[model samples]
Target: MRHRLYVPTAAAACLLLAIPASAAQPTPGAPGIGDSYYPTYGNGGYDVSHYDLRLKYQPEDDGLEGTATITATAKQDLSRFNLDFALDVDSVLVGGKKAGFAKTGDHELEITPSSALASGRSFTVVVRYRGTPSAVEASGFTGWLRTPDGGVAANEPESAWWWFPSNDHPLDKATYDVSVAVPDGTQAISNGTLQSSSSKLGWTRYNWRSSKPQATYLATLAVGRFDITTDTTADGLPVINAYSKDLGANDGAARASVERSIEVADWLGEVFGPYPFDALGGYVPNVPTGYALETQTRPFYSPRQFANGSNVSVVVHELAHQWYGDSVSLKDWRDIWVNEGFARYAQWLWSEKEGEGTAQELADYVYSQHPADDPFWTVKPGDPGPENQFHGAVYDRGAVALQALRNEVGDKDFFAILKQWPTQHRYGNASVADFRKFAEQVSGKRLTELFDTWLFTPSKPSALSARQAAVGTVKAPERPRSWKKIRATDSVHAHRH
Candidate 1:
């Protein structure tokens, strides 16, 4: 696997600094990355380029010790910066020199480097930390999934805080090289391809490399016993799927659904352009959680997703994110519709391909269930606040909004928008307004009212406009049970939705 690495040079570092001798003074980096909803989600003043995490885990006590080497570029002249972390730090190194460090907040590890970093100068921060990730909690929820045998680091919006120090948000994406040393029998799985594994003195170390840039939330570390399978698609793309050995009754069904990742990804490519990442696969961690996150090239699946038999719709949902969410992330968490909405719509597309239901039928059914007085219509999918970020309205009604857009713009431009959006914003972050503008640009249509009603407006879109008229027909069939099951899959905040 090939990765675009940032190799810093003295000349390059010197050229980045535009310090004036008269009025020169170094200052601390901002604690927050300027996110509106979650103000302090990620830190500012630096953009991470790559994270090399070398970790050692013991499943018995769920203890983890690791050294995280982060390569980043300074966006401004900075005296100090912060990394989101919860573990106990033993030492901190900046540019190979010991740095002054302290735990300022619940997850912020503030470090003042030995010397100020010049603007645009590439730098490295090495954090040596140890913690029980599964025990670390914030807001009364833990991101690490601790199973009987081992644990898995996988969650949305936040997870790296528990296992590794990072600029933990979707806004700052970076490639990862994860090396984990565990008991000889257990396997360590992570994002992208497994580079190599070697055992020494009662400990086995596995090395994994993710060549593609990924959000910190999407970077996963799972240490456990798994039945690993490897294959290739017809186009020769690598496929690697792993399942927990203790899945029990869910094993067969989970395998049946997740194993179809390559097939579903191939079909999604026909609609959404080529797959973004090099490796293609998913992992089932035997977790009882209800969510499945699109963790870069390798998504993390909860066993509950397949409890009711093979659920290919969920598979389609997560894999579609490889393009929509992983490849094209969000400018802010408020534009979660750009992720959940598109992923849900892809599930509808899958249902249509499988002869189960068309996107129109599914949209209408969702629209029918939520009446005029239903509070569901009050939540705007485009700018859903932090409280209702993962609301069903975002996934269900958001997709309905897309169906209306498809009808408003016609299939030609709608599909064009879907296929082109990823290409236009590949490996970058975009917002809902960005998507609306892209849609309007691609369709050559003025869709202000349509977007306002479906995305921005709070009340049920009752106005008899062209967008509503397109999906107002009352011929919706019985709601799919699998879709109902989807309502329960928002593990981040499933109860709130």
Candidate 2:
């Protein structure tokens, strides 16, 4: 889990003075309004306004039964309503009445409303399902147990079978309140703050409130016997309530980074604005996978990597996502840079603060690694297959794009724009073009070519020297540059195409 970190001493002072006193206002009457630049079938043709989920786990059968009450707001009056859901659901109900729904695939569901839902109106639909879930290979959507000797294993992609009906795409977001009834002693965790929990009728009911909008894939539920530790940040926000069954083994190292996590949060708030969630925490599950997930308020970490410091970067990366991916979501998969790029950039910013390297040094290192022919926004402007959207092309290359912009606009203005972005578009969505216009407006520079070259085109811009010059003094170190060789790996299964 060892990784590189960079820190910049002088850049912080320079960045504070770079921005102008006055902020630029967005232009009025722009076409394709909202965060996304491209046209979208709003709510993906189905409006999931709210969800009430009740799930009961049966460890004896190694399965669960979920009953969901979905309330949708219709934009158009139609005779038929379609809902997407993972395979394994048994039945559905519309307005408290049974309705026919057929499973089209492992990742899709088709349902006809018991009655037509008029435009500008809302209706409720419920689904009852049961299945033995299978976890996707290496994906965090896994359910498993640990051996007595402390080895980890799982059944992943379980959302396909164990969970309630869902669109299962990042673009389709909705509000959910989940209540899971697990065996008496086991704990259950999900997105957002916990509302209430109690034992009733031989089971424990864990109710969670996710007031913020969230994509279905980011939704999670963990049920196991875990030791819980809770603390709050200096700012009074819940610091970390990390959980693990093997407390003595990994807790010490994981706890050691808690303050660092808060420090990073405080630093980011100074640069990017306030932390987005009401609470921020991480979970170290006893799992074999080496990857992590940014699941809204709570992120999941692999216990196997908990002892290694390299996993702390995963914390930085995922926390950055709270502002980038969670707050201002991407409308389509192709615009995933809106998620990964900003998160990756935040990691670099953290490095700069940690005295790992100057921001310029890190930027230079990233630029040196990118292929000359690859652009940050090369993914097609549509639903570019999932595989094409989440790789280093989006993460590393996208961070490089922001670094280039920082170089061009200077750090002060660059951070102002970055801080302003989430505040203005919080809980909404955004695309690359929308971001470009916003950046241009904030910096008072018409950067169409810069945008086109780094994002839309197929190559890195040749004006790197000029761009660096615009940002003020940045001395490129002559030391051997191996940090640039640390390319992001395409090994995470959840990110697979």
Candidate 3:
């Protein structure tokens, strides 16, 4: 379910009467993930097809150095090619041969090709580099945290190059075969299913394979002391992984909640589509920060939030991304509702199934509770404010838009859209306009009005009569005071603008 909003000419003027003095700029072009600059590799350089990584971690120095063998398909004749990587890389090699490459800023590697890569041909580049991970406040890329037991914790985002060389953008989707070698007694977990593990030369090598094409930002790896737990979904999907050093102390509780994640996955598949990945799991490292991330194959969970039912929602949120965020990703950041909104809607759907309420009840609750003064489509998915992007508007308002769409399209057509969406656009990016076109095509109805009202417009239209508000009845919740509070809050918020 998705909705759009439109403002009438005269009414739009009235609404903007109190707008802030500063004019909003037109949305910028899609910037590469984790960095604000445009990418050079995809413009006129090498097109990376695959990557093979051999990484060595140094916990004492809080750093990692890696040797990356990248195979790229050339699109044009070129004597030099540039690669997008984070600031920490040191060197580059062309076809196993040393090549001169210079570091530009902290996010790009410029390589001078020894020989021109002819168009319609493939070439390999091997890069060797080392660096200590640095925290990126811009998008929360890489950072280290101090543990309670006097140890350090680290996670990489679009900024994996703070420790390793990576393409680091969503558009450059590629298949990765990675092998991480860590110190004795420590474990390294990464995207995709684990292939095998062997100890040699006093280092443990964990090999992982991600056959599915993945955006660079979703690529991740975590290294620490962790306890492993395995399980199976009722539908027979391999659910055999959860990493947490502390799970040993609370094995019963952790296992129970972890097992419930499988049930949630099953429900999402039944409602939406297939699981969209080969495997799914989480790693709860013994870190103090209560932050969770939806990496490609597995999401990194924070143990602090897993205490009660709180972690369950996080699990559903990340799992939903396997379809919305991972499978059919957003082409640009400004269209973030494609990711966060769908994932958030899935969370609400899971809650409704777990006896939270029926779909209508949940939709009514969102309509009644969410602040209507804010424009849903005004939120540019890419450069949204920190709190507004992933959590508030992208998640809550975006889900509400979907619910609104469901109301307009009906169940049969709506679910059909959901199931076909990932399958139709696998490994590709989509925008709001693309979804709107698809919906109209499937339902055989002009939904221009519904989309305008629900998405582009800043406020909900006047309540419709029982017969006019689509199908189903919404039994208004019992709290009259709550309704009044919400209306008053919205009025005030709108007045302030």
Candidate 4:
């Protein structure tokens, strides 16, 4: 049945037509999301809420083919938009209608919907793609790691581009459901919980779900033969630890450290706040990348992190990031201090608990070792350029700054700032300035002078302030040998951030 509306009169029709219409007009979305350091890292004009990926892999050829269904809401009316991806696309569909698509630049896929997408309209983008991720490189490196049996998708700042299309930045966090089909006899591990696994006709499909919002850099998955372990925290959150069967001599140390995932996460909760995610675990993949990454609930560890022996300090560093780096992420790459500083400080705290050294002792010792004229003082952790984003000063000096703050505000306020910072910004992004304001608000003290001396100034402070020197001054006796585990230069390469 059809209903008809009557225009009562020509005057009335004219009056209705005279009313204003919506102001929005379709325009091409920005090609980049405006990061000063890495401008082209993410796209603008839309926010992804979730991703549902269906993928299949051939380990023998390192080939991957997949269809990605991205759910997002347009922030502005748009005729076209971009996604950060590096793959061979076969077809694209916007809201079930065929859409035009083209590959642009090195890692961007520009898409044109059949019609303009109105502001605030929820839409679905389905992209069909296939490629050998190991062969694809952007920004002069490949995030995909090909192993003897299978491959691992794990890297910092940018990894999803090689394995899955995404709004590839910490600023655009979204939940994910990744389903990968691989040949039988191999296990696929990913972030969050394993939803389902089924095998049929010599192929196994493993579906993993990340119920919490996760940054694109922190989302990871690996498919290979593993010695998998399962446990639960006191809070009953599931813990899944996996180590490649071929770890050789490092196997014992890897398990010894990663096995403490449950213990370490719980300790971090008491020091920071309640664990932010629903799951807890770590994996030691047999890759030579030397650095371990805090990848959401399941942190990834390179075998070399344990080459010397058991390294629970590195474990503490990565798990602390579950709060500092993973739960409350960086608003921009320049806020590297907010992540590395807090994580390194946690290592110092762990040292105190293990009878190694107090945070103040560790801070003073580090300060005493670096001379006033040393170039180390020239690198400001708060604004170290892109080239020095992961420089050792960002980690060591960053933590030193925290100890200075603790002394300035006293223990009560400093601990409160630590626990509250993550609670206030849980599952979101924050800048170092935002953190300073929060600290000042919580401690009721002006921190600009302190932050300036430690974070902003490109040179070391004239000397540790009286508050910073309360722990017997920088000329204290030799620190215990165990201090090695408390510093970022501990040979573990925790500076991989």
Candidate 5:
């Protein structure tokens, strides 16, 4: 519940401008954040604090006109900086003045400011672009999905460049004010709370604001004919659910699925501390992305998956991610189990709460389901390869690992570790190493062997049995057929290896 907020002072800004760069003069910022899996995704030497994105969509041409104004503070003296962008750029302006820009490398938009930026100096860069927006293809699905009337922006990992210019990495968290204009009959929705909506001439614009520091991957923009419903949670947080009207007879069912997200959101607050944001909601689109993403306050869901009676548990998974993945993000792709494992465990916990099964029983099922030489057991959930980032090992096996830790440390320490992990690094970046250290610190127990056996080792071990023995015996309840479907469909269960 505690937050480390940074507020700029007038004196600080004045002092920063008065200072000068080193004798060598300013230099260009690094083109990437040095991530092991994605070294060229995010730029370094500057910290983005806010993004003001204005977009207008023309249905006639399927073209999107956009202007992005990014506010950031220089971490070092910089003559130039890079923004991850992949669109037809009209112009680039630095600090309200025209600046020279060029496209270099894969997705970098390098811009040289008119004047050198001193360390700690606050500055803004505006980029104007227009093009027929296209989604970045990956793993057989596109990040920014196109719809019948308009499109939905759900870029995970490294696809934000397909629509907007940004840092485009999970480590660089920034607040957002996204305004989108569409035709009078359509709707525009994004993250956070709806600030206002207005009509001018023949276009209607909806403005949204996410004041919390959010990673760019969680940023989203949905424009189309949607059934927008406004409500509030029991805790007073705003609820904004948007369902695609393309469902026709199933539109009501889709809307109900999104409304059910509030129940999961409310329950997640009780389990995983506060909700961590000012709002909670869901965006249901007809485009079947085959997966559900925890996109900030409003997660996007495929109509086929969400309205099929298994909505609550999956909603719980994504809402739990609001605390795990959104608030405390991963430092590298290898640490993705920290995001996925926590969510998978949340699914187990919710199912146990509903009397479907106990967390231990479910963990036991997944652990025993695979054969001794199965490749699923060979793939380390914590250190899966890039192609297998979302492998079942990362989910089912990851949950088994957490349950094993719980068995070793007892429920009191395990739940405490859960709450403390996110609260300690709220709205910040963390890694598997960070989680290991923090787990040991909070539980007052050394977890080196546990992590080694579960995360680093390629072969399955007897740890699951040892932990089960330590926890005593339990009856395995009958799992619902829906869970079987979850394992059957690639949406929830797919082994990459």
Candidate 6:
């Protein structure tokens, strides 16, 4: 049985009345968004536009010196602000002048600008620090880890603070210009297109620019002795695939996976609309990290993950995330299923396309593999606990939610949702509530029960039964359904603004 929801049109108007109108003096912005899972994840009252990160890393002793210059706009009258930074700070400057700063509660760098920043005013904060970078250990994994030769910064969730300071939340997406000076023998790589590299005085400085808007977590740097391979896609998009020199015999397999990433990018662009970023590539560093992450333009893979061979399925999964997780970010950490779920469904779609099995069969296999009493279902996919953000429920059950929605709506509408969802919210933040509204608006069918059963509820969703009830009872409103393909010619990158 599907539940019906009635959303009142005046809900926003009602909420606004609760806020008292006053010409109050400037005060500090809230330290956090009050996320249920990670309360102090992101700051309040301002939005970041760009991050200029300049870092000097010495791999011999793992010493790091960095200065992060953040440009942002104040969303409200504010006397003070906060940046999520875990590293040691030596000095702080606001708008090019010295500003008073002190390390506050967990990961918060409180700064008082030389003058109070008025509402809508833009400002810049620069922090210089030196330290041996540490990792945030959570969910039995660390965010940043050091390799035998160099280090890899994969700051997923909230680990970006460990390396550099910024608005660490996903909602505050910003363009990045990351320049790192490393030892002459080693190489440094981060997100976005390569800008320039110069070696002088026994140091090599590699500069990478992410012109597209990127969440801080998806911004990455891989520093090591690398076997660099650069090429171009059939469409002339530059590709740079870096493999760790430590992958002795596995270099061939790792390189093949990189080459295959180009093919998968083309295929996915055709099906999921155009590729979201300027370039496509990946890195296979033998870092001890047990998982692979979809870090914007260049995904990172651990050599251990491809032990069997070139795992094209993993390649497909991560590349799909370039469109899902990297481009269309989540509004809150609780909405992580928005990333994992979409990537899992994309893998299933690729499998179906390759004649392996239909998405239906894969969904059935996943559902049947776990009993209803398993912890996977106990944690809600949409709002899992902080420690359980990557629970199986978010991945498997999340995909099941999309499959159920597809079943309720036909194939045509389902594919349309996939393409439209990313296109509309490209390089921006969205929540489960936001997604629900968008799905309802696009499919013209009420999806209250469908999202409730698979996302918020603890019980395993019976896809066939629930979708059957939905399609049999509900009548979707008629609206003109059109698929508009957004090519590079039709759209401009959000960072351009």
The TM-score leader among the candidates is: 4
lDDT of 1 at 461: 78
Tens digits of lDDT, candidate 1, 87-150: 8999999999999999986888999998899888999999999988877776677888889889
Please give the TM-score that candidate 1 achieves against the real structure: 0.92
Residue lDDT tens for model 2, 80-184: 555544436678887777777775433445666666656666778888877555432212343444322221222221232236665444555688899988878
Better of 1 and 6 by lDDT: 1
TM-score, prediction 3: 0.79
> How far does residue 115 in candidate 2 sit from its true spot (Å)?
2.0
How does residue 222 of candidate 5 score in lDDT?
A: 84
Q: All candidates' TM-scores?
A: 0.92, 0.79, 0.79, 0.94, 0.90, 0.87
lDDT (CA) per prediction: 0.87, 0.63, 0.63, 0.88, 0.81, 0.79
Deviation (Å) of 145 in candidate 1: 1.3
Candidate 5: segments with Cα more than 4 A from true spot: 1-21, 135-142, 248-253, 467-482, 485-497
lDDT of 5 by residue, 1-497 (tens): 99998877999988877785465578899999888777888999899999999999876556789999999999999999999977779899988999999988657899998998888999999999977765333334445677777887775676577678998788889999999998898888899999999999989999999999999989988888887788898878899888888865556656655678788877777778877899889888777556777889998777766444445666777788999999999988778988999998898888777777778878777776776789988888878877778877888888888998898889898998888788899999999889999889888999999998888888877648574568753654355533653453337422121
What would you estimate as the lDDT of candidate 1?
0.87
Least well predicted 10-residue stretch by lDDT in candidate 3: 488-497
Is candidate 1 or 2 superior in lDDT?
1
Better of 4 and 6 by lDDT: 4
Q: Against the true structure, what is every candidate's RMSD?
A: 7.6, 15.0, 12.7, 6.1, 7.8, 10.2
RMSD of 3: 12.7
Report the C-alpha displacement of residue 341, candidate 5, in angstroms.
0.5
Q: Runs in model 4 with CA error above 4 Å?
A: 1-23, 467-477, 487-497
